[model samples]
Target: MTFPSPKAEAPAQRFQEATAAARTALEQLVAQANEAGWGTEEISVALLEAARFLNEANRKDPDPADDPAISDTPAKEQIGHGELYD
Candidate 1:
């Protein structure tokens, strides 16, 4: 597997920045919900779920440059080119 070049790092950095922005926005929404007394059981649960999902996503490792599962062989050289319905 080929590693990513330094040029590829820009997109990852941008994604991290976007994620941080989204988290900040969501935190503001949570605070607003609290101040507005909008925490019904369902709304609270939904908010908790959203927070959990975002936290879990942020905790994950960034995507690796090379994926081991991919083969070096060209696609045309691989088998299984026949029609599926045949």
Candidate 2:
């Protein structure tokens, strides 16, 4: 394994610390929102949008059209009955 240089190390550590602090801040904000009566649906949708934003920001590949790893096959759907019926 390779170690980061002295100059690069501080910035990397700072980034790591910032992300950790942000996670705690987000948790507290979500809890406050919940206590302030934001419904599950609203909170969930907001979080989902945040996730999509993060994915878009960090994605390396903008297109997967020619990517061989992606399957062209149609998805197989599973039908389920109630627990008692099953």
Candidate 3:
């Protein structure tokens, strides 16, 4: 008798793939909704929630080809919050 070695089930991989697909769908939906002149607050909030969900699911940033929505702006910004209180 041979015991099966420990390994991830096929369903686990499928689930991860499904999660990634959902994230891609969401990103495209958000872009379309935004372009269609959907409410700013609604679109912004939805995108934020989607990002949180993907992060929780352990999804990495989409590939360049897959990420048409990638930001073009520089990452760093000088802090301009009011003068420090003495």
| Clashes by residue pair, model 3 | none
Which candidate wins on lDDT? Answer: 2
- Candidate 2, 15-60: lDDT as tens digits: 8766766666667767878999997578868987998987886696
Off by over 4 Å in 1: 1-9, 40-86
Tens digits of per-residue lDDT, candidate 3, 1-86, equal: 22334245698876776676667667777778989999767987987897798786565554545654424423342235332321
Candidate 1 lDDT over residue span 1-86, tens digit each: 22233333588886776676666766677678778887656566897798798778666834434435445655665556553322
Record all residue pairs in model 2 with backbone atoms less than 3 Å apart, i.e. clashing. none
Q: How displaced is residue 7 in candidate 3, in Å? A: 17
TM-score of each: 0.37, 0.38, 0.37
Full ranking by TM-score: 2, 3, 1
Estimate every model's Cα lDDT from 0 to 1.
Answer: 0.63, 0.64, 0.63
* Model 3, TM vs. native: 0.37
Estimate candidate 2's alpha-carbon lDDT, on a 0 to 1 scale.
Answer: 0.64
Query: Which regions of candidate 2 fall more than 4 Å away from where they truly are?
Result: 1-9, 39-41, 44-86
* Two-way lDDT contest, 2 vs 3, winner: 2
